[model samples]
Target: MEKTKPMVAVVDDDPRLLESLEELLESAGYAACCFGSARGLLNHGLSHLDLLITDIGMPGMNGFELRDQVKKVRPELPVFLITGRHEIADQGRAQGISGFFRKPFDAPALLIAISEACKNRDGG
Candidate 1:
């Protein structure tokens, strides 16, 4: 039987970034769901998502807030944070995320991290 692709949700306020991430995720062979805001993601529900990658700085909800809400509902879900601000990375705010990436991160590395995260999720 063929294996199903993991469904990953990518949330960001920037339309360009969302499109870039969607292309990257698609090229990596995963199913990508793009959301313009945290509220938009919430509207879709989290039950079907295998992973979540969200921007740390958004217009309203923000990534940390979104991560907190998601964890409250689904603690086991793997959520990764991406930030354009270097200060945000220095603040040590990434508490319960599967991984954190700064802006202009290596796409290959992100793909490897996603693969590893999924493998670990399945193994445990």
Candidate 2:
């Protein structure tokens, strides 16, 4: 039987970044859902994702709040956060995130993080 395609939700306020992530994920053989804001993501795509890769900076509901909310709905789902700020990494780590990728994150590192997050989500 064919395997199911992995579903990753990529949320960011930056259109360029979101687009790049979608392309990257698609090239990596994952189906990526892109959203411009946390509210949009929550309203539309939260429950459908196998993994989440979100940017820390957003207009209204920031990534932290969004992550917490997503966790509430599905605690076992893996969330990989991306941020340019290093200071908040500790806080995110403390919250039980699978991985935190620094902005301008290398493709391999990001891909590995995604693969790891998928493994963790699948309990493998």
Candidate 3:
């Protein structure tokens, strides 16, 4: 039987960016779930989110803090953080995050990161 495709949850305060990422993830063959707020995401989020794509500098809950919280609950889940701000993105790099996307990220790069995260979760 074929393996089920990975599912990704993308949370971003910016509606336009969130939509763009949803399209990007879907086009790459992974399922994409989107949320506009961190609180909403943490509450009714997908339990089996194979990957999480978030912005690092959200107004309420920043990605680093959000990622840390999620890791405490689900460390195995992959978290890819996006940031248009160089400082924030660079800081997240050292946080053992799954991937990093500067604003205007390339589709292939994001997809590759998702693939790697899935592989890691699968013990590859």
Instruction: Find the candidate with the highest lDDT and give its number.
Output: 1
Put down candidate 3 lDDT per residue, 62-116, tens digits, no spaces: 8888998898888878888898997766765777544888897888887887888
**Candidate lDDT values, in order:** 0.90, 0.85, 0.83
21: Cα error in model 3, Å:
1.0
lDDT of 1 at 62: 94
Q: Is candidate 2 or 3 superior in lDDT?
A: 2
Q: Rank the candidates by lDDT, best first.
A: 1, 2, 3
Candidate 1, lDDT over the whole model: 0.90
lDDT of 1 by residue, 63-122 (tens): 999999999998988888899987676565455334788897789989999888888778
Q: What order do candidates take by TM-score, descending?
A: 1, 2, 3
Which segments of model 2 are wrong by more than 4 Å?
90-98
* Clashes per candidate (backbone, < 3 Å): 0, 0, 0
For model 1 the TM-score comes to 0.92
Q: Could you list the CA RMSD of all candidates, in the order they appear?
A: 2.0, 2.0, 1.9
Residue 19 CA displacement from its true place in model 1, Å: 0.6
